[model samples]
Target: MIYKVPFVEPTKNYRMIKNEIDAAFFEVLSKGDLIMRGQLKQFEENLAKFVGTKYAVGLNSGYDALHISMLAAGVKNGDEVIVPAHTFVATASAVVNAGGTPVLVDVGKDYNIDVTKIEEAITPKTKAIIPVHLNGRVSDMGAIMTIADKYNLVVVEDACQSLGGTFNGKRGGAFGMAGCWSFYPFKILGGYGDGGAITTNDSRVAKMARLLRYNGEDRETGEYYYHGFTCLLDNLQAAFLDIKLRHLPDWIKRRRKIAALYKEGLEDIEELKLPHFDTPGFEDVYQNYVIRTSKRDELANYLKKNGVEILIHWPKPYYSYKALELKDRGFPETEAICREVLSLPMNVEINDKQVEYVIKTVRSFFK
Candidate 1:
């Protein structure tokens, strides 16, 4: 059964830029430079300029970005890296992939890492902190940065969900030692296929990340510097991303408009908790217009049955995963949020009629 409003529609977005994308494809095809060449270099430069970073290295996927960031940050076996317990598993798995132990911490009301709890979790072995900017909302980087400075810990930002989000007028990827981003089709700044990047002001970290993403080889000489993974972003995907980047500002503005509409329609419902779009010192891109309800499962079922497609950002917290060996360790806030949060149909392609239908359907369920 097809739903009236799908959670995301990358194909519709692709169609909007098909001509430009086709042109880019042919240009790259004509050049016959498939790997990291002109298109990838230009994309990296444009992305670095956009995010206010000194360097940006493109990779195959966001997981590679995070994993490469950890390696570049000097995270080694037996070292501990703090990560939010409520995020996508990749946030924590990156630590393990880099040979560091992931120390989980619960998130706060804003659905970001609770900086207050960060200090207690730090130890002699703690080498880094990976703060996930979940739902296109920048985490409290002001506090997280302070803590990192105090502990001399590396801060690798997971800005995959928050390409344009800003805090205190600073871009999401600008505050950390290295920022990892994703171009998964579902993300705010999506690509046609798997793509990712790491941004940083530190030249040393930038160099390491570049090497890590490209088999640790010297780009100019093609000499192997160290053992590394083959994780370069496709030149064609970079071209697609380059075109999409031009419209990101408008896309973010539209997402904010949709969030405003959601709040206007749902704010009065006592049982539902809407996202804090107007948080001081922060500008959210509304990557996923998530709302919380006590009757989450029932409401989701009702919406699905009625032709409105909805989803859960995550049905389980990171700590609850058996592979993490953290069951019963109790992250109450994370657990509660996992059970209640629901992501509505959010994307640039969603029309006003679809938005209103979602609103009406949600209100009908509560009534």
Candidate 2:
């Protein structure tokens, strides 16, 4: 029997609860509120409770969530916001969109911001630090938070890849002033299309974020208005997300189980370096299940030829391509890792036999 492999499959909890979503949609349609309505409110409240945050503001996309957070945090033009050089461009672009200059920082071997190197980069213009939790692993928040306190710099966690992930028992989106999440169909707690939320314990910051998303309407009066962009999450998507939210904990556990199976099967192979999920007290959701290999491009081609799918999370670092000011600075770690990182087949639906087949194919390539 032949088995076809896929790179990353979004969990299918939505399929199992199709009737619930249909019923919710019918109720929404009957009420004649589709855009920003009761469904959005319910999702925000439920998501906040799940993340253990005081407030959660839903937005149009993760990019928008980051953008709005920067604005709410008082980021201004010419102000410097320190960010990792290795993440998706959206992490940095959102800073620019909110009128801040993004200063690229190098990442450590764990593929997160090198906390040790952050102090030297801080300048008089430095206003905030955006710690990106890439590939579902938590960046060293304990250290990062300490640094932020020392400098009085606001921390905005870019937790797009780490919805169910945690650090030191606290969830990913609650460590900073506000943590940004992207529901771009591929995230663990994804919706049907573009969606995002900002989770935070600070009520003032949360209030600002909510106002920014709805064209600056005062939620209390529904009367006052200010200049703000329209980027609210749709009711239909929220209805769907509410259904999937119930099973998120189970889905996250299943992802970790699959990652363990991969590690056990592939640990002996020296050619591959797998990700680290056993960070002291935190649990990684294993969003991408990336592996590092010297011959990554060649291995990817071989896998595709053998009916196994693979993908590169990022081919270039954010600072190298989008922002021109930081081009002269060299980030060898980011560049080298980008060249070698390849994502394997990962999802809850993949059975034991499929995992074995993938490991066998990978080992055969190395041999």
Candidate 3:
């Protein structure tokens, strides 16, 4: 039997909510309330409330969220900010753009920073740690925060993939000094276009970020604060995000249900390493439903031939690239996982039958 499953179909998700989206789309444009208007303010307020933070500054993209958050939290030129090597290059890019050197770290099987090894990597020049919450699972914030407190380092969470995720009863963005989120169309709380936000309880950090996102001009006083970048989240996009935000809780529930199905179907395969299940005190939102296997390349090929679309998060670690020139970085676990990690289709649009077909097809390959 032939089966068709792409990684994620954002169109399908959009179709399901077209009316609400159209209503929001038309409402924003008709009013000509573009650029940091009511919609943006509403979305920011709503996002902050949802993430349990005192502030949420909407930005053009997640990279800006990370970069602005770092600068706001005092990451300076030549300072070292630790990050897991396994995540998207944007995490490291944020560090570089903030004028800090990215100190790459390794990751565990859960696809998050290896908390046990973080302290060993700390240095006197280390100013912060950006524990990327990869694959919709939060890192061990307890360990991360402990290390940060010990070193007096800032904790800027790359919570892009873990919007609805939690660790130890705390939401993804809430655990850090500032948490950065992405609203790319693929994210759980995705928007129609590029959108992102920074969540923070620290009012000063929040204020600084707000200033930096615009031209460093204090809107209230019409005074220039500092030279900043033009990277504000679109008001229309914010309106759309506000609509999607209302549906996020239900979407997260469906995502978790999908994760459960994946775990039940694939856990028996000794060669395949699944992500963590309902470990106590963690509520993973299952952003991509990743699995690791030594036979990743072979399996990926077989799945593609049989029409089960798959993806590798990063074919190689960021530090492996020549442009960055950090080949000396020792991320043993990251080096190992680069050859094995695979992301299965884990979007809300996927039906149970599609998941079953994927599972059955994967089993066929192993046999």
Candidate number achieving the greatest lDDT relative to the actual structure? 1
- Evaluation by TM-score, superior candidate among 2 and 3: 3
Candidate 1 regions exceeding 4 Å error are 326-328
lDDT by residue (293-347, candidate 1, tens digit) is 8899999999999998888978977676676765344588888998999999989
- TM-score for every candidate vs. truth? 0.97, 0.95, 0.97
**Lowest lDDT 10-mer window, candidate 3?**
324-333
Per-residue lDDT over 77-178 for candidate 2, one digit per residue giving the tens place of the 0 to 100 score: 889999998988888888888889888888888789989889988999999999999888888999999999999999999999988888889888889999
Clash counts for all predictions: 0, 0, 0
Question: How much lDDT does each candidate structure score?
Answer: 0.90, 0.85, 0.89
Of candidates 2 and 1, the better by lDDT: 1
After superposition on all CA atoms, how large is the RMSD of candidate 3? 1.6
Sort by lDDT, best first: what order? Answer: 1, 3, 2
Q: What is the alpha-carbon lDDT for the whole of candidate 1?
A: 0.90
Instruction: Show where candidate 3 strays beyond 4 Å.
Output: 1-3, 277-279
- In candidate 3, list every pair of residues with a backbone clash: none
For candidate 2, the per-residue lDDT at 6 reads 69
lDDT of 3 by residue, 86-162 (tens): 88999998888878898888887677898888888898999999999988998989888988999999899999999
